[model samples]
Target: MKNHLKSIVLLVLTSVVIFSCSSDSDSSKSANQFTIEGQSYTLIPDNALLELKMDNHIMDQGQTYDRSSITLSGLNGTTIGTASFDLFYKDGLPVEGTYTITGSLSDNDPDFFDQLLVDNKLCLGWTSSCAVSEAGAPTFLVNANNPTGTVTVINNGNSNYTIQFNGNYRKYDGNFEVIGTSPVVINVTTDVTIQVF
Candidate 1:
């Protein structure tokens, strides 16, 4: 009887441990990670490289849309890269919804967000390999292939946002030649109170 009771208690403890661990896996960004050009990055709640800021509403095509600028960047000693985009909503303030990341940076659609194509020399940095153009700007022979992704924002009802990034960004050269690609998957919970504009 004693041995049987001990076995039952151990089973209960094991079940509790498993349940607790799995319950909050998707609740935050700590469990999510992404890789870019063979460099891996993990999105933590307070990382400097992950940013989501509210911007002023803009008028486009006779309609006003709320805007939010997002930036995700990281470095791995030798190389540094960044992805930037803006979210626009035609309705009132931004709400919890999954928005598509349209590759067009100048898109006039009031209900969609746009991605700003990043130049390899500017956004993807390899200090030693960057070439300066005649305009005194560093230029790269490559750029991203107009990354497409989904941005899912969850408002915690407390001015906090839980954002998720799942997309693909490929490398393309100035001659439109394909070089490489990387899958971007990140999750970040950030406070927008300080970034409200």
Candidate 2:
């Protein structure tokens, strides 16, 4: 009876270990999921891209600033979004400072569905006015009009940068003329750093 009891205890311990490992694995997968406006989405990290461009120019008032353009793409080469802003610099180059870029989606712009590319394919069809606002120098904010949220970008210097989308909200049409919200969080360490020069 003693030996039988020992065997049963060992079996129970083994089962517990297995269960713990499986639970951990499942939780790890869930970590990749994010809820925006109550809708959950699994971010495809491999399909993200970001590009930045800088141009120095003098205004009519003889003030010099750097005109910067940022473009974000996902699911492939589809342009998810773009922003343009001017930054004042003392030496014809943008100093390490926080800058803001704001723009609105016009009727001539591409459809929002075409912009949201996932795995080299379009996700869903959405049409709405989206205003983008982003800042630089540490903590950043990428917010839009319809569905509002923040996006963070980190510049590691040497033209290397990282882009993160956190709880970004977007508005879309649901069934029966109902409007819905979709929030997304995507953190991607791009293979190629966005070069700003």
Candidate 3:
């Protein structure tokens, strides 16, 4: 009878531990995020999209390249912001690795996916006409152009991913003019379910 009771207690304790572990794992899966300059935006799965364009372009006589682009958008109160990146792959889809985000791509190198491009933006409301303030209806727009950064993409399998970006981005206004003399420091980490196309 004592052995039977011990077995029951052991089963209950094991079940509790398993349940706790499952809850912790689920909690670790955070919402996707887009950070630009110094502001952070939380993007839901529905608002975030990752498109894989196979055979997007051809170069080097007849070599085909695939393009993977991710667009993350979210709204903070009345303001809306977006962050996006484009990565080119020589063969197929991009695997788990760290990619350089740069404006320059060399035709001599066959590895086109090694270098990538990133763009970011922040605005007021869903439309361009949305007013931030009544004082002359000023709008805030920023872009990361000719950016130099590193983005680490980890494929968690089954279209799930965790991407981390740390880099210096050139800030450009809506008129495509450099905003400040110094580049903007942007760091973003997001866990998302990529929608492949």
Candidate 4:
């Protein structure tokens, strides 16, 4: 009877261990329901390149969006303006992030990578290459000087994003504002979808 009881105890312990392990293993699935159709991504460059609405370029960028850098933006306190973003595959999951740009110095003419790094290197300069600020916000070129502040990633689809550069600034074009504030912060929301075959 003791042996039988001992066997029963061992069985119970094994089952408990298995249940414990299974519970822990199941937690991995508790994450958000992130799905990728296959391996395709939609990308929008924050630069004038996207402004032109060139079909060919957009197609090309999407083909290799994961490897390339593209513009990305989000609303500040308020939320308006659209910042283009690139979505790609990482570790079997679709990931998206912003591209850091240094605009060219001269408005008259620009060289390759025309935008020079800001003195602080936080923001890109004003130029053809540097993506323009939201349609109307007050924005000029990098002014041939590095931006003082750095831009940060407010949020990420995957990990809890930490702040990064401070440049991709908000040029007020007199768009939207807070209820009471004169020229409140711009609120932005952009959603990019990726379809993989």
What total of clashing residue pairs does each candidate reach?
A: 0, 3, 0, 31
TM-score of 4: 0.23
Residue by residue across 1-197, what tens digits does model 4's lDDT show?
99999999999999999988887652232221111111111222232112111222211212221222223332222322233322222222123233344433332333312321122111233321222233455763211122223333344453233223323333323442212211111122223232233
| Superposed Cα deviation of residue 97, candidate 1 (Å) | 1.8
- Which should have the higher lDDT, number 2 or number 4? 2
Q: Which candidate is the best by TM-score?
A: 3
TM-score for each of the candidates: 0.53, 0.36, 0.55, 0.23
lDDT of 2 by residue, 2-71 (tens): 9999999999999999998888774554444433343333433643333444444423233333433333
| lDDT by residue (tens digit), candidate 3, 17-52 | 999888765234333445555555555545454544
Q: In lDDT terms, which candidate is top?
A: 1
RMSD of each candidate relative to the true structure: 10.3, 13.6, 10.3, 15.0
Error of 3 at 164 (Å): 1.0
Cα lDDT of candidate 1 equals: 0.49
Q: Give the TM-score of candidate 1.
A: 0.53
> What ranking of all candidate models by TM-score puts the best one first?
3, 1, 2, 4
* Backbone clashes in model 3, listed as residue pairs: none
Ranking by lDDT: 1, 3, 2, 4
Q: Which stretches of candidate 4 lie over 4 Å from their true place?
A: 1-81, 85-99, 105-110, 113-165, 168-191, 194-197
